[model samples]
Target: MLEKLPLGRPEIVVENGKQTTVAHSLKLKSAHIDDRLLPLLPTAMDAEQMRQRLAEHFREHLPNFEFKLSECHIRQVYYHPEKQCGVNYRLVFDNGNGTVFHEWLYGLMIPQGSATGRFERAAKRVKTSRVVQPFLQDFPPVSQLDDLQMILWLFPHDPKMKRMPDAVDPDFMKSQINEHAALLLDLPEAEARNWHCD
Candidate 1:
């Protein structure tokens, strides 16, 4: 099946007035082309889009919980060639009775020559680590000793497909949601309070 895919053009490099054609071949693992798993894959999205999607996902799975999204600003953390960028944004969940859980979410930006892409990526990377670190004392807890935890980082679109890789499984997503929901629901009020933002 992989062999049926079209090949890309050879890369040509010119150095010192000499042109060289370098052959390139497509190398794909079996999982990459698995037809059975393609429908379950996630599409690539930017940071803000990811945040909204995640909030929706959580709401769909755990309808009883209240989820809120906010931007976390960090000052002078990331210095891009074009502009300064912060690191991350945040998602806060509450039971509407003062028990809240905070998760710092950020997207890993693909390094690019474009100034806009460069700045956006740099901002999210820095915001998650720099700003969240001081307030929580440990932005990402070293141990999973509690229910409250930071969500996973988001990734940008694949340059080729313009979306995420096909490896993301719906079952895996469901499991993650279930695990986190269970942990959050089981957390004691005192412990949950500790996870609240200010």
Candidate 2:
């Protein structure tokens, strides 16, 4: 069914060499998510154990590249040892990539909650925000996760897409999904435009 429909949503494809906005570039400065850091932090805050759950990604996966958050400025931090759900370790910087990751991971648990926490910028695109992290060992296919992976599967390594739960689409969603893949694959802006605007 998706193959028959034409893509109408035009995307704003910014090239790799292309310069990003001050806010965008600044955000890049504090981007990066080091999976290695996962084990470094406390097990509870590091990650949760569940059959299926959503997770927000970061621009860099680790903004500082080292994932050294020994003193990450905590804003509206959340943590629940009993429920194993909370935003206990999040970095919210008002300067440049403020709420860069906090908001991102927060978006991951939004559908289940009231979408609390800060970085209130009208959540980006859900297509890249919602993800199903099945632990490398579990390795759940991007398809099995379904709605959970609706947002994250498209852009697995984008912080901007982390809190973008409002980005996914059911209306010609495939086109949007394909458009996302094109953008990630380093397709030129002109070429990507053709894909999304088709």
Off by over 4 Å in 1: 1-54, 57-86, 111-198
User: Which structure among the candidates has the greatest TM-score?
Assistant: 1
Backbone clashes under 3 angstroms, per model: 7, 26
Per-residue C-alpha lDDT of model 1 across residues 1-198, encoded as one tens digit per residue? 112234442111112223432223322223222222222111212234545655665455446534454322111111121221122434564545666656544422222333354444433443322223223333322111011111233222121222222224345455554546536668755665445322
The lDDT per prediction is 0.33, 0.28
Cα lDDT tens digits, model 2, 88-158, are 22333232433232222231222322223211233322223333332221221122122221122222323
Consecutive 10-residue window with the lowest summed lDDT within model 1 = 141-150
Q: What is the TM-score of each predicted model, taking all chains together?
A: 0.24, 0.20
Worst 10 residues of 2 by lDDT: 21-30
- Report the number of the highest-lDDT candidate: 1
Q: Residue 40 lDDT in model 1?
A: 15
Q: What are the per-model C-alpha RMSD values against the true structure?
A: 21.5, 19.0
